[model samples]
Target chain A: MERKYWEEEIETMPRRQLEKLQVERLRKTVEIAMGSKFYAPIFRERGITPESINSVEDIKRFPFTTKNDLRSTYPFGIASVPLQKVIRLHSSSGTTGNPTVILHTRRDIDEWADAMARSMYATGLRDTDIIQNTSGYGMFTGGLGIQYAAERLGAMTVPAAAGNSLRQFKFIQDFGTTALHCIPSYATRLAAVFKEQGVDPRDTTVRIMIIGAEPHSEAQRQRIEELWGCKAYNNFGMSEMCGPGVAIECQEQNGMHIWEDNYIVEILDPVTLEPVPEGELGELVLTTLNREAMPLFRYRTRDLTRILPGECPCGRTHRRLQRFQGRSDDMMIVKGVNIFPIQIEKILMQFPELASDFLITLETVGDNDEMTVQVELAKATDDFQLLDNLRREIARRLKDEILLTPKVQLVGKGVIPQSDGKAVRVKDLRQNH
Target chain B: MKTIKQLSIFLENRQGSLKRILSALSDQNIEIQAASVADTNDYGILRLITSNQTKAAALLSDIGVLVNVNEVLAISIEDNVAAFSATISSLTDNGVVINYLYTFSKDGRLVLIVRPADMEKAELVASAQGFQLIQGWE
Candidate 1:
């Protein structure tokens, strides 16, 4: 018989007991954070000692950490423990600026795996399952982070790190693979490959899919579920707080249950920097309570989501978070209209005639700014009227949402460049002029 | 029922897009018997009468180019203005409208490739007028 919970004791802990654990861990995290070169002076200036955190609410008094702090400190300044004690490090891509690094002790790596294991178990993956991880390994934590968790869950893991869709199918058939972990965009592209190769995904051994590392709409998730014939679960995690395991959706498939035993979750207005009303949309702020090598104190995640109100049918005391809307930094301003890429994605995915890939281009036309949305058609058609109608419908739907008409172009499949890495959805050409 | 198989390809209005499609077909040794490009500022459609369209469509699609196969009327006529006008008037006088038409000349023989708004009407009119309609390209 399958088990009800991964760690029933911790997962189903009472609310009062959970809050007590959070307070105790919060104090410990504050002390650990003070040991770092990055937080020592800041803690002194803010008069924040371990005793300053009486309860989880006291976390509001502590100074909020930003990405700029991580960048300014560079590679090792954020480590709470000595460099000699650290066993591993993961750094994100620094396309915009200096790469922010997260250091981990041997114990920290173990705990990260344990957390990820719990998340996988919540999605009904068991030791009997063969998990194939398709995320790239190395510095990208999704690769190693998920790999360790699958191993910790006692599942047979195939570390088929990223790309080479042909080999992925071979492993799925030959190994009798039962689960897959990959980003959402790559998941859709994989579906296309499955079609091109004439493989019926529903007939395969796969039953569960864990998709993350990019913001996707509910429509997109439903589309993936229909294509892969599996229960697609949304995973919410950032490298700052161990990747791929901080939160996960259970079989209920309602909202992602954030692991409260390991971290304190806070939702705050991005501009006001104050906590929003319960169940209101805001930026997610996190503080690590279990990490040893680097215990980030009130680190701002910049991701926009809301803590779902009320209890989940699954009965986990930990709070559930709605799927991330978009990053605060990812919002684009076009002619005084604020728009998130996910908003466009939500509308596009609703249409079955369209493919998963799209590119939003902002350009300067004469003295005016114009937006053009280039999306791919799922298949080629000789009917020009059908293509024209699709373009107009997409434009009309976008105008209804954004209040500005964008020039919508329906292009051929594979016209927009798709890479093994994250999909680049927006291109601002107005910067050139 | 007598119609020519034409491959209509979607091409983005950017540098090297047409070249990429042409090079892919060229590498496969696919002969392009006739070609016409309908262009706009953002994108264009390249229509072609190929020696082996089914093979050409499969090859181009495999290379990530969008190709659609459709049947368009191909009428053989004299390489003169009068012959061209007569063939077009035969369809228009029978209440059929031509959406688009492109011509190709080979060895003093002119062929008008017509994509009529109403294909059934155009096919009946061409057959009734005894116009030499090319069925499948050699």
Candidate 2:
């Protein structure tokens, strides 16, 4: 087993050495951005100087790059490198609005693969493991990104793409897949299929199941483990910040460890844009330390999370990030109370009967914004009254868990639509006046 | 006094999952009058018409299915080949593109489930053409 790059660096370098590396990388990144046509004007207009930003502390002098900025510069506006130098491009879902395109050079691709390899190592995925990649491919980075890393880490890669559960199950059985990478919801569905097929996931050779893309709760993780009989790992990343390997849960199953050597992460107040105190919930902001093609300075990810600044039990010195709370955009104000759909999902998935597939409907009932949770029950038993009992149970759970009384409508299995790529969990029906 | 209610139910792409809801309704003795399924790789929308709309909705809700009830005009025809083509021509003549259509029968009535480009215009054209537009809830 090869020691991770960060692990090696932390063990060898003193605090000063890491600080120096960050300063050097930051300086070079700023200079590259200043020379670029896209960012030069913005920085010049803001009266910022690359020379003034000599250290990590001087990072505050730079302007923040947002999703709107990426959208405004759509297609190929933010390309710091020439069009010929760029090798590949990835994009956001754009379901909320216009998709943001991320361009990567060959070097960027190598770094991304390295980062993912680090993540794989952190999860104890060995070279001997037959890693199955189930994330959606093409334009989306999840499948390809993880594939490159798994291959780089010496793990035999199974590029399953997405969908075709029957084929996926066959691969798991025949290929002797030890590690799996996919969305948490899909992982749950796979487990359900395993149960329905009467296959024991525990008895199988599968070891680590890595899940990402969506914010999954601890309860959901436990359920997946119970169903699959494997240890489930949570992964966190976005297309803008490179892909699912930006952060990963170590074998300890503590918070996901962020690769601070390559990227600097901060939690800030969504409104104020000021760094929040440690342990306080805030929007996550990131700046790439060594990205050449598209280096983002103070990029607002819109994902809300806290930084757990400490050394991990796994001996990795890189800073760890808590699981994402919710997105700034997904936050709903119901009767002046701010609620995130992930919060509701976490509460609902605690029940064994309820599947991760649920819908949050927000509509204007009377003068106020009314919220309803339409939960999809997994399976139907011989007892019909169990349906009513499940609804009441969900209602009671929501009341007790989230402290909000939401109208619980038990939706039939398959009633809630699924997505091969990004799962659209919350349906906000409130008209924007 | 018999009327049929059309419903659009969104479904996730999972095997044998739709059977749960359909079985629930079947257990209540409610029969599906007409049905069609439009599917993508990840999700499907099951469009249905039942003998009893209120009972279907209640049974579906009780079993925890998100059912959206839609009112669609089911035109009773003679089941002749000309009758079906004439219905299509009539809508085309009125500049209405049929969004979706399905044919089925109940009792002696040969029903054409017509979803036209314009609901109001389709209603007017059907009424003007002397075809009885099914109205009210079952």
Q: Going through the candidates in order, state the TM-score of chain A alone for each one.
A: 0.79, 0.78
Give one digit per residue, the lDDT tens place, for model 1 in B1-138. Answer: 799899988887778989998888899898888999987676778999998899999999898887889999999999999988887887898898988899999779999999998898899888889999888765
How many backbone clashes does every candidate have?
A: 0, 4
Q: Candidate 2 at A87: error in angstroms?
A: 0.7
Q: Model 1: what TM-score?
A: 0.62
Residue-wise C-alpha lDDT for candidate 2, range A100-188, written one tens digit per residue: 99989999999899888888888888888999999888888898999999988999999999999988889999999998898889988
Give fnat, all candidates: 0.54, 0.11
List per-prediction Cα lDDT, in the order shown: 0.88, 0.78
lDDT of 1 by residue, A1-433 (tens): 6678989989999999999999998888878877888788988998988877677888888788888988988988888888999999999989889998989999899999999999999999999999999999999999999999999999999999999999998899899998999888888888888888898787788899999988887888898898889989999889989787999999899999999999899998766689989997788999899998988878899898899999998978889999886687777888988887767887899899888889999998887889989998777666667778888899999999788999998787666766543467888899643
> Following a full C-alpha superposition, what root-mean-square deviation does model 2 have from the true structure?
17.7
Docking quality (DockQ) for each candidate: 0.36, 0.05
TM-score for chain B considered on its own, for each of the candidates? 0.96, 0.88
**Model 1: per-residue Cα lDDT at residue A244:** 78
